[model samples]
Target: MCGIVTAISTDNVVPVLLEGLRKLEYRGYDSAGLAVLHEDSLVRVRSAGRVAELATMAASRHLTGNIGIAHTRWATHGEPSERNAHPHVSAGLAVVHNGIIENYEAIRERLTAKGFVFESETDTETIAHLVRDKLNAGQPLLEAVRLTANELEGAYAIGVISEADPFTAVVARKGSPLLLGVGERGIYAASDTSALLQVTRKVVYLEDGDVAELKLTGYRIFRPDGSPVERTVTVSSLSADAVELGQYRHYMQKEIFEQPQALGNTLEMIAGGNTISPQVFGAHAGDVLGATRRVLIIACGTSFHAGLVARYWLESIAGIPCAVEIASEYRYRVSVADPETLVVVISQSGETADTLAALKHAKQLGMDKTLAICNVPESAIVRETALRFITRAGPEIGVASTKAFTTQLAALALLTLALAKINDRLTADDENTYLTALRHLPVAVTKVLELEPEIEQWAQRFASKQHALFLGRGRHWPIAMEGALKLKEISYIHAESYAAGELKHGPLALVDRDMPVIAVAPADELLEKLKSNLQEVRARGGELYVFADAGSEIPESDGVHILHMPEHYGMLSPVLHVIPLQLLSYHAALVKGTDVDKPRNLAKSVTVE
Candidate 1:
């Protein structure tokens, strides 16, 4: 994922763009660049590291302009290098882009045949040349951008500025996120509102197939066919304090502890008294519930895990036949879909590339009842779908998601209850019980956080291990997968998760004394079966760290350490059990000397494929 910011102002815009880039750097940090229209020409500066290096280079020389575009890149088409960085320029136009261009190779070859030279291996460089070619053919700047956008064949949010039109900037989006911030003197465009939060509170989220022309006065939106479209500017309530970690040592830890409050706020909005608002479900929920014949859940990464859990809840509680698919693979397979099918896409960042693609693909297949469960209120995914439910997890700074994942689960649980109520599947007693359980969740989460000290003590025993295994059954199986993912993502340890019953199939052979086995042993109907699975690992001489419910009998073994968590109500245990896993991974990564906030080769948001 890359970050892009552009400003059209009366004063010089380089300093403002640099500030915006610093705020947006969490999206991507491979390289950074800025291009400004200066003295009837385009001036460009770029570097191959973090934004600090680029700022140093920019400080060495004076590059003055009132309008410009900047980028912090996460390389996709080429390796991270100075030449491969963004702000790709040709003649008078300078461009910065986020997302991939699927047809760049074909377009590059055609341009090469026309005797046009290339500068770098980035797919974005091809856009600059295409715009220059259009201008060379006697097209105006707006027409050139329109033609170039029409020819591109993949996800992108591109910002374009030209010396020929120094007072204006143009932006277009297909799959990635882009927002226009309305201000008094000028307008701002960025990949996310975080970049513009300091300057303006009002924003217009650009829709797919929409083009924005930013000028000194204001910006204009147009359809793909050049038809004017009017949009309302919504004011954002996100403050600067929300993005800060406050007094916490790490963002992951802060986010982990914020779960209880975030869930409480979400529940207050949905289940508060006298509020029977279906609009909270989304604008198209009525149409979707009435016309839907089946349901499909699509997502990637942690959101995929949430969807997997939702599948169980939806099928068992709501009596809806549901199927869950990883968004990356969903589009490749030929599946049955129609106007009656409701496709639900889940993602923390609505700009997740694969999920957005899956959403568009579902729409193309005539699945009009598309709903998105996302954290960002005005993300590209929210704009593309007719229905959306925004998670109240303010802003997750850690590269590995903590609060977002849990908040998504909480939201999905609400959706399940809503479905049950609408379908007459839940009686008054059942509804009251579910709501009561939900209201007590924040307190249960607080009790779960008390297990941190014990988890940290257990983490020390496995800090030197080369590999690990996690096991669970039923709903906890997804939690097992998520636990293993968090460990591998941050600790750089080889970890694999398996269903407790499936351990003997082939994964058990890899277990040894040097390998750590983390078992989720919450007290449930399948507790005895899970205990037998734990015995199998013990027999294999696997170093065991079991997270069990309070008062549960964890058999004494020489190398086994039992972490007794507070007893939680059934179906609410997953939320409690996840706390220990998070603490284990966090402490393990801290001991291993890994960056807890910014993991390697990963960004906070996956806006590009």
Candidate 2:
């Protein structure tokens, strides 16, 4: 995935483009570049590092223009270098692009034979040349871009600046995210809202296969049929201050602490009721849930773990057959999908590439019932789904998710209750119990945050360990997986999770005195069986680090350590149990002196495969 922005203004657009690139750098920061139309030429400058380097380079070279395109890349087709950087200019056309062009190789060969000289090894470069070639054949700038788009075969959001059109930059999206920001001073297009938050709050989200031309004072959008289209300019509620890391050392920690408020915002709709209303999902939620015969949850990364936990809740509480799959794998494999199945896609950013692909794949299989539980309002997943629940976990800047995961679980719990009501499986008493638990959830998570000091001490112990094994049973198993993922992601430790029952199934051999075994010991029905499985590790001399509920009786002895939860939250225990794991990973990564926010080789949003 890469970040792109196109802007034209009466004021010099260089500073706006540079600031936009800085904000979008979290998408990818391997390289950064921008191309601006100055007088009669496209002046391009690129650097092979963070956006700061690009800014320094441009400053030294005095690169200036009023109309421009910018990009911060996460390399997919080529290495991250100055030559491979974006703003690939050719034949008077300067282009910055996000997403992959799958048909690049074949198109490249055809164009090479046509005597078009190539410079860098990039799928994006091919797009630049294709537009350049079309323009060289006397096509107007907009027509050349339309011709170039018709020749492409893959997901992409492109920004094009032509020397011929000094005041206009064209942008397009197909299976990738793009949006336009309208301002009194100028018009802007970007891969995400963060890039335009400072410039304007009014935005128009572009649909797939849509193209637009941003001009100095206005913009126009066109459908795939070349007909002009109008889009609503929703005033985005996001503020510039929400994205800043105030006192927190890292974005992950800030997000972790934001769980209570984020979750409260997510639960606000259902807070006053005794039972969940399907209206919380969408206006047609009740009709969709009432007809759903089964559910298929698709997601990637931490969102996948949230879906796994939802599987247990849906099957156990709602009496629905639920299955969870990694979106990347699910997209490649053949599967039995029915029209009655509710295909649920979970994502924090709503722009996850593989998850969006899987959502489309399910639709291709004739599954009409779709729901997206996501954080961002105008994300691709939410836009494509028939029904959607927007989680209010605003602006998760950390590469590793914290508040978003907890809020997903909260939304999924509401889904469970709503589905149960639809199936007549929920009793009045049980509904009241769940509603009360949800109302108290924010307070519960607040208390869980209090355990950080104790958990950090445990984290100090884990800093020296090279490997870790995590265990849980039943619904809590997914919590174990999330715990391991957090540890490995930020701490740079080798960690793996196994169902407690599966310890005997070959994974038990990895247990040793030097390796710590972390267990999610909630006082559920599986506690006794999970304890028996833990004995296997204890017998193998594996040091134990158990996050047990207040009453869970998982003892602390010589080699066994027990960090007691303040209370037992029953089905909601996963939300509480995970907080400590997050704290442990955060503190352990701190001790290890690793990059906690931008972990190695990972982007905040995986918008590319």
Please, what is the TM-score per model? 0.94, 0.97
**Model 2 regions more than 4 Å off:** none
Error of 2 at 238 (Å): 0.6
Model 1 clashing residue pairs (backbone): none
lDDT of 2: 0.90
Candidate topping TM-score: 2
Q: List model 1 lDDT by residue over 279-316, tens digit each.
A: 66776676567566667999998888888878878888
Q: How accurate locally, in lDDT, is each candidate? A: 0.85, 0.90
Candidate maximizing lDDT: 2
